[model samples]
Target chain A: MTPAVTGVAVTGVAVALPGAADARALLHPARPGAGPVDPAALIGRKGLRFKDRATQLGLHLAYAALSDAGLLQNGELTVRKDRLGAVVSSNLGNVDTVCRAVETISKESTSALSPMDTPNASSNIIASETAIRYGLRGPNLTVCNGRASGLDAIRWAALMLRTGRADHILVTGVEPDNEVTRRLVDGPMADGGAAVVLSRPAGTRARALLGPVLRTAQPADTAHQLVRQVPGGGLWLSAEDHPVPRSALRNALNSWGELSGALGVVQCAAAAGWFAEGNKSPAYALAGAAGAVLLAPEGTP
Target chain B: MTYPILGTGAVASIGADADAIFDSLCAGRSGLAPLRAFDPSRFNAQQLFEIDDRQTEGIDEPGRATRFLVEAIRQAAEDAGLPEDLAGIPVLVGTGLRELRTLELWWRDGVPLDADGLHFEDALRRHFGAVDTHTFAGACSASLYALALAWDLLELGEAETVVVAGCDVVTESMFGQADRVQFDPPPSVRPFDENRQGTILGEGAAAIVLSRSAPAGRPVRGRLHSVAVNCDAHHQTAPDAAGVEDAVRQAQAQAEVTPADIDLVVLHGTGTPLNDRTEAAVTARVFDSPGPALTGIKSLTGHTSGSAGLLSLIVALRSLERGLVPPIAGLADPLPEAAELRLVAGGPLAAPLRLAQVNSFGFGGVNAVAIVGGAA
Candidate 1:
């Protein structure tokens, strides 16, 4: 079945990757950092000392996305609280907390476990933490779809806008570089995230228009199908590290090495930035095994 | 734009199928028993209502949660009379904490970390042939969110059919956490009772196949009217009456129903002092007088975490079909402070039930409410 096509707009975009502190840096990266950057300064030093690393990444990206959308000025939200929804996507959500909780429960008495740190073990707490910190009172949803979480979240947020569920939805994809996730992957995974503000098509910062999000069975063929479907000499942005000799292919996963949940949105945001800078080509992002979304410059059709 | 629920499937402690579970519930059969899945002798509250894994003896899945989910989904799919081609259908599963025992085994045995938390979705995709799969983990209300997502997909015409499932198995890690926090009850789950101590955690799984319209000749179990989810932003562990009340009001508004229209309420009564009291207050606020029949199935199933919400949905559907709302299993005396709302006790209450509301509250102040209508 074809999804209900609505006039959804990409009002703002942001990223929290290594070396690049904000959305602008991700687009214009003079030197990509070799590893994850400590986001303590961006999140401030007062109250977030005990927060999990994933939550810190989520907060930084949420604020940056809202700020880029002009919804936040001086750290205060410009729009009404109830009209803004928050959806956080993650593959390995707060794995550090889970490992810690399990280890604590195994070794020490259950009573001795740190009550403050135990709440962070849950997957939904990341979104809840971001919402509580920023006072976002709209529908808060936490989606986990492995690598495809970011792109799926983008699609879901667009539907939320189309159905008038929220005036503007802040969608984020985040994962932390921790021991648990690292061990699970048998290597170091990048710790970062990407966020975008989805709104009605009539916004001041409408940089790109979202197309249909298609979910195919095979991840191997997703990139090719997505690239072949979009015809008009546009760019194809993807999280795939290597490509098959495609001229319009631009690999964002190389610079931002392997952000599991954050890969798809990062590609989409970077592609939007390229389009904002006079590149009229449509950008297609293939989120591994999940699906793909084709983003075109405003008024492309 | 009404989506008909084609069928419901469950693998709980009481029974393995929806019909048996419904029969057990209506007959006032309690599934509560001492923990058998694991030796809970050393724990604070050494009692739980665990699903009998022997029934699923031939399943090769390593994780208990995965096994239960696969069986439940198969039953639901068969009941829905699904077509041979299963393409273009999205699968949404909700879980809490995952299978802790298996993870611990893998962690301590130095096994390759390939069995990540998202492995369950991969397994479902491979075994069930569902290309579009997603998982939700919002504590006790996770599966409700899964069902809500399926509803949205159907309402938006994103998919013709969607399978929403939820499963979770109690493990030593969970029991240890609860014991450490002193949240375990000594006897049993006595919901809304004056002498309630706490809750006995349990494990189970359930699935519902939702379609835009009912099948050609199959029976429609119920119709999902509306669902609303919200967060309190209050304390992480504490119960918030205001948030629960807000969620109910929003659900009622969306469903276009008032307290007078509600014939029954399936509460998320965890049997804890705070949760029961907060749930009672929210029910009283919604209805000025003694509201519709209020009951909780946690007394029989224990708290199944992720699967609790869908299990409660199954119980509500059963109640609507049988016109009998089951009483609180161990609730001997209702707390006078929470007596403003009618609590089904002693035995099943027979009434012409039409509309029922299901409430599910999880950690981190997450509250979800959904309205379901009986068969037309």
Candidate 2:
């Protein structure tokens, strides 16, 4: 049996989806044909030129999440640099940059490649950039583990807190809808970012307590297993096309479109919002290959 | 909460299996050769550590990286005497450029792109019947990150057994980028050498099977004592000595061992000027004068990128089993800063190895260090 992850609480939540003002908007169905995200409007114009779309989206959400957690004030961190950690998940975060660079190299000479853009080719740029911008000197990790990346990032952050590696961890999942990503996947994609601030439940108001993530190879099995853990009258959120019968189950993918790497975090943000609205039942979020996480409202043992 | 290393596997330019690679290392064979996977005339540096085409002939359809990874996992499972149907065992793969070569080929040759092959989960599911798979892309330190997470899973009782693997293949995009960045790139990689030019990309994969409990009737390869990961939050391309030092200190602290107790140190010597210097400085600050015997395999294997971490760990474990530390393949004149440290060179050094430390630092200031104890 996997040990229960106790004392880790979600203190803050933020999302940068198109047509969504706050996390609560995610609880409702997403607006039809939402316009593309404008990260410049949310964050700023400066430092937006060199960053890729995924990084831009991630930065905006991280800033908002940090502020919501009361850890950031006026663009400055309120906690020690070493006590803060950052983990970002995106399966196709840097695909556009990488594909563009590859195209340039194939068509033009190596000399045509800009040195400034070389760093963006690295997959961990988003996570590292977030840490550098926020002065998060603690353990930084980037998860690109396919569909499970977002939830895996959350699980990794929880382990970091459980092992006393960091007092607080900023977890963000972002995916960009661009020429390359569109070519890779079919159908409209949920191209945005979502972030949650997970920290040890000490001296902080907890919005919800995170339970251990249960994983299985098959999506149907994972959904069934996840549903078995929570009590009755809980709201279940899943992106998989599993046929699990539940009284109050919602497929975020149907409502928000295909979120890819951002689905898990978006589902998590929605659950946190659900709790913030004074709901008492435990909320569950499950992504097909990513497994499931149970979010219990505050004061749950 | 130490996890026992039950089995090991590897596929590199030097050899196909873990034991063969270790033997090649002990014999001081360098895998550096002219790049044959792609046209090398376009790049300033023409040399790389590329695996033989014959080895991946049958399984090179989707990508050579996947081929190497699948081969490595098969070897690891076979070595651990695991069932043919892996059923519920979870797989965690670390990679820098997952299927980028395949994507590049598709773009260049107009081949039909199969999105399923872009990630390792499908391949794992087909090959080993692995249902749960996690692919980490943390650059060069990716596999170590996966290994660290594997350890966490075992420690938390998430799974009794876990498969950790890392793989990457040389892509034209990376080659072109390196050609532009490296100043007068040399044909060979020479770590710790004063004239070390830059890293030569390598293609390969390595895997290790770790278990919470020792496998019944099977000899344990080693015990993973601790793994410490951190970020400099300093630079994207440049490594920070402070971050590297912190990781080394934290690993030693978690393992409850002093520098003197470690018999060997597998340096993440990328052969890049800044990286080697930063690593040497960190080594000097952490250990006493002429610290534990240090060896950099990149001089022979070229920087394997994502798989480099596990390859180094495998070398350390092999050193523990064979009592022979492989020498740095192409080191003649050590950097003046690294002179105080014991940089093994010329030939393999015989020693009664017990504890070994492996360092793997990557782009974006990502750093991971692992300390492993040999089963004597």
Candidate 3:
């Protein structure tokens, strides 16, 4: 049975893509290989020196989104910590850490493994670190579903809210550029991430309402379903690594290169930004096979 | 909005089937033995509870962990009486560290690595025809995370049937890492016992089928009442007693039951000094003096990493059905100072079981708890 559409709204969003600081910049690429943003420069340098790039990018986007939502003032959270939950998704979690562990064990002995680096090897530690930093005590999860992870994270967070598990949730996706993932995938790899702060529908500062999400066996079918569900002149953002063909609807790639797990949320943020502007047309962000999310701006017919 | 656990299956070091495994666990049999699949001479720990792939039926491949997962999922679906065509069913799996044995072999002997096997996600798609598949990689707590996600999907009415599974193999990489970090318990594992050293690595797979309603013919084991997930925000390997206590309290409140209603506590019990101590401290603080009987299955099956939590859940449900709690293997002498928890030792204790709680904590401050109420 398909669950009811969550009456949740995406109040604020932030993105840190390659060569782009914000979502608008993300839509318009500047040059070849935007390169990763210096995470320390954006979110301070202390204690972040040894942290993996994934964590740095995730933290940067989350803080930026929360800041945009007015939840953070004077570098402090105005919302209750226990009421906040976080769901972070990534395809290749801390690949650099895993590679480093392999290098260390190869060079010396297994005992030479750094204690600090050992725990970071786990994928979920990125989300855990974020929670620890902000003291968010609500439901915390890390989903690693390859390219579709970002959309799955959003859907899961929405379910948490619908079930009264949390009042607010930070839905995020982050994947860093690394040689290991580069060798595995075919397209241009990039380090980028996007975060969206979701809250109950009755709350203020609503940017867009989260429409029903469709999970089908085929990406094209899911796109068609989204079109039928929200029939209008809206943009269809494809965040998949592979091209999704949908000639019937106005479709476009994320264009910020291949962010893998980070692409889905980035696409959602882009659609939200599109609606945030005067454009009343609804938008849907579709991820790798089976994950698609629709966003309808407030007051949309 | 709770959901019923329709059926369960397992492929562990103890046994391939859940009922046989539970019987062995009740009989106080240990699957811990010397590591044979790989050479563990360099590591401080020389033993592991390794499951022989050759012995595991339906395991076509030789060394890949994917085979174990496939076999386990098939057994679980069959046990649950799921239709043959499971095209759209959601499959949530918890997978541990990447299988690096092929790469390690390539690095050591210059042998060409076999890249034929699929990753965890691909394997699920190919094996079970799962379309909406989500894999969780949270180190040791991976299976618990998967189970929690399955619970949410069922409660939210998003999925009528969800398959939650987890699998990991005893790779050389895991042994090396465990040995380097001093997480290896030499000789054998001893939980909540004085002079306890640490945990031993194990390999296996376990799967459970959950549905919004009960299946026909098969008795409902229990209803997954609530799931509470949190992070310690503390150290990586070491757990904060306060964080664990908070998770327990939150889980109880969500289940709408106090600690007094719990009949058993299935602990993570990695058998490591830090993990056992922290869990004991947390349990003592949360449950009453003669609180829910504390028991652990790791002493018998070893720590199966990603699959440990699901295995614990299977054991707890079986205990609820049989009204008996299995003894904590290798726990000869209970620690006198840590007497706050009523640790179940000696042998299987026959009691009226109703509600069971399972606790799972991973390397990275990830804490997940689930409360299950036995069927009426």
Candidate 4:
């Protein structure tokens, strides 16, 4: 049975990484339509130590979601040992580190490769590091299904939770664009990690409103627009900001400038941005990568 | 809830299926042969349970690891009897190398090699998109972890039937690890015996179709109870002896079966001194009785890396089916520490067994254990 999503909620979500926020300013220049914004040189230096471009953006978005949800406590993020798992999506990881490792592995095969480079090379480094530092010990998966890996990871993470493999789930979709990564993402790319905190249905009014994502079919007409495409087994969707946020799901090209991978981050970005107040019988709908929608709040089902 | 072991098939030098291999193992025959992939030149010792192209022939070309998967999977699928909802089946294939030959050839020689590591997944996806297929690699524990993933999928109801496969073909680069890694003994692999050397690299493919119900094909041999995989975070190559033992106990406990219930044990014997001794000690600690009739397969098959776990389990099942345990092929001298265990040396021995445990511990401290019992 494709279990119906009874409730759609977010609890505590935090972004704790070394250098994600500040590096983003250098990369997230305003596109033609998003209105004029001073480029990185004009933005004040928020210190280089904290921003890994993508992680930095992840921090703000994730922090805002958690803080907005009123779930923030001591900065110390704690999760159940086995029930806590993290799913993070990324289009481009630490490309600088990847390129460095490639050069070193290829040219410096005889010499000892840098231990420092190993962590960054792993596609799931963000999830691994986050869980290690945050004390979460559950299912952890990272996917790089082109730009849609983030959404795909979240979709799977939710399935994990729905299947009772995990209790509270951490879904983070991030894409940090780097110069070296551009070679890989020559078509399009972006920077940021979008995270969502999910829990079991609490049967509250908030559970009644949001409808279940019945099906998330392959991005209908949107698949044709992407510059770089890979046919991996995961769901790939690009989200474009609608004329109004959440007004309707917009394809990547229309949203924020074709958020190829950014669409995955946008799934939660759009969900987290929802200012849905109290509505006891909240309806929830979880759409999959291939247009399979699962409605929640089984009481009605 | 016991996860049914629907159907299993393995491709190795010994035999492609259980019938031929079981007889071979029973007669104390060995499959370990010199490296056939390339010329065995100045390298120290080159023996492995090499696979014949007979198993993977028309399914794939060029004898690549991923192609090995195709071959083994084809047989396993045929053995699985072909479920109606083939689309919903989950394909979980394990590999330590991740098409290492392909990766190496691509990186070093710039030949496209085998695209199975990253591309064949798409083939499975397109063929079985309604079905979920995933690939996992963690050096040696690849298939064991895949087994665990199969269990999780069954438990999670991701699919009613899941195919867990492990495959690896020796690559020149992988062959170099024995020398590159400092711990292995010189050249030869001698498990549980004094003066034991480290593991000799080997490769093959084994796949088991897992499901919630008894498969219509063959009578099931055993049921997979539980699986546990843990990281040492201690070191890259070395085993946290304590971690290994704990993982074993935890997996058994999670399966809710005591060690006393097990009649046989399949060790991840790499034949390295550290491994043999540590595995024996861990077995002593986990098993209620000493060693539980120790059996090692590497002496006959070398080390198949990711496929080792499934390979060993298949051998164990073969032993169970014949109601006799196979001997450890190359134990020259009895190791002092492993003396208590009844080692089936030189040839196969008769034993009534119902339950068993298997281990697959790999580099980067990845460890996995699976407990299988007579079908419920």
Docking class of 4: incorrect
Chain A TM-score compared with the true chain A, each model in order:
0.88, 0.92, 0.90, 0.62
lDDT of 3 at B58: 27
lDDT pick, better of 2 and 3: 2
Q: Which candidate leads in TM-score?
A: 2
Give lDDT tens digits, candidate 4, residues B1-376.
Answer: 7877767788766776756666665665666665565434423345555675634332223336766677677777777676433565667776665554544444444554322233245545554453345555446776886686677667865568788888877654445434334333345567898987677777678888888988455677577877776544344456778768866887888789887887888888888877778877777667654547778777766788878888787777666665778787777686876767766788777888877788888765557888877654
Error of 4 at A54 (Å): 12
Please provide, for model 3 over B195-234, each residue's C-alpha lDDT reduced to its tens digit, 9 standing for 90 to 100.
7888888888888888898866677767898888776767
**Global local distance difference test of model 4:** 0.55
Q: Tell me how each candidate scores on DockQ against the true complex.
A: 0.45, 0.61, 0.41, 0.11
Worst 10 residues of 4 chain B by lDDT: B54-63
Considering TM-score, where higher is better, how would the candidates rank from best to worst? 2, 1, 3, 4
Model 1: interface root-mean-square deviation in Å: 2.4
| Most DockQ-accurate candidate | 2
How close is chain B to the truth by TM-score, in each candidate? 0.93, 0.96, 0.93, 0.89
Instruction: Give lDDT tens digits, candidate 3, residues A144-174.
Output: 7776777888888888888787788888888
Which pairs clash inside model 2?
Answer: A217-B131
- For the predicted complex of model 3, DockQ is 0.41
For model 2 chain B, the run of ten residues with the poorest summed lDDT: B53-62
**TM-scores, all models, native as reference:** 0.92, 0.95, 0.92, 0.71
Pick by lDDT: 1 or 4, better one: 1
